[model samples]
Target: MAEPGDTSVLATAKAKSQKSHELASCVIKEPLFSYAHLQVLNGNPLQEPIELDALQVRSYCTAALQQFLGIAGTAISIDILKVDGSDCWLRVPRDSLGAFSAAITAWRGTNENGVHTTFRVKGCSDWLGSLVGQVGQDTLWSK
Candidate 1:
């Protein structure tokens, strides 16, 4: 059995929602650029920090992709946004984000001392501004 009051309330709510949607303009959404912020971690966290430059980071990423994804991995284009100590920021095509992240996560990184290391994804986003905001927050709250 349906209550008369309940049916009227439901009808009113639906009418309002439909009217709201009808008033909105049509807008097309385009794909956004994907970015990943990563931290380099050594096999032994307590050991000396691993220093990496832009070139080293690029090679490391390529090697990781090659190790995990093989020949197909080489096709991925990566742009190194910034590199500071063991932390680095990178950009990849939006469509290739999944493969890039997967390859990096699956591969184990090694250092000059024969110690193993890996890149850890700290944050990923399509908007660079939001990513930079996070960095600011970290600095503000850390002190």
Candidate 2:
């Protein structure tokens, strides 16, 4: 039997207290916005690569929404996070992801200067970090 003043008992209690203090966690069941990784594609792969600016991205998304859902779709908020080459990142209300995805997928692409352009959703997640890398690469197995 261990005595009330036993050093081992006190040490064990201290260790448990320290362990609890060392660990912290926060769980968000529902995020306010979801992120999407979009790739802009043209009809011809051999054509010059498309470099999209913020304005162009907004215009494309807005046009898609407008065409799909009319005035209501146009009101859906879209935030463009980054645009590199033909890839773009966007954030939209968590509840509106389905509508947004449908809009982009179904809309016929626009033709400008004989170049046809459209958006494709590569991946989407409530957490942005999950969509950061190459869309299909398994990060765990990659060097």
Candidate 3:
């Protein structure tokens, strides 16, 4: 049996407690990227469905950035993660999320073939999983 004043047992207990605490707490230091879920919309409800390709997505984003922030804004890197129908997923630098979002929001949509199209930012998150979960919820509620 251990004595009440046993320093070795006390140190062992302290070490085990510290390890458990460390395991329970997680600190994500400076996440490198942020994610956004966007949907394309057209002004006319009677128009055909919009199908976005990678090139079109990039062009639209570039135009918005250039319009909002000029050359500097155009320099912001945007990664197209996935494109499905009218919806797209994008990854951008964590530092530029605000500027990117603002650019998309403020720009007037482009008109092509009498169809006016614009991007709507459905959601944004530093963690992609959160944005993905939100998308799932949106689908659930939408149906």
What is the per-residue lDDT of model 3 for residues 5-31, given as tens digits with 9 covering 90 to 100? Answer: 999999998887784343476689889
Pairs that clash in candidate 3: none
Q: Please estimate how well model 2 matches the true structure, expressed as its whole-model Cα lDDT.
A: 0.90
lDDT of 1 at 80: 96
Model 2 Cα lDDT, one tens digit per residue, 1-143: 89987899999888877844636789899999999888889988998878989899999999999999999999999999999888899999999999999999997989998889999889889999878865657456777
lDDT of 1 by residue, 30-143 (tens): 455688988889888678888889998898899988998899998899999999998899999988888899998888777666787889877888777777667756678678
Best by TM-score: 3
TM-score of each: 0.71, 0.81, 0.82
Worst 10 residues of 3 by lDDT: 17-26
Candidate 1 colliding pairs: 109-117
List candidate 1 segments past 4 Å from native: 1-28, 136-143
For each of the candidates, the C-alpha root-mean-square deviation to the true structure, in angstroms, is 8.1, 4.2, 3.3
Kindly indicate the candidate among 1 and 2 with the higher TM-score.
2
User: After TM-score superposition, what is the CA distance of residue 32 in candidate 1 from its true location, in Å?
Assistant: 5.0
Question: Scored by CA lDDT, what does every candidate get?
Answer: 0.84, 0.90, 0.92
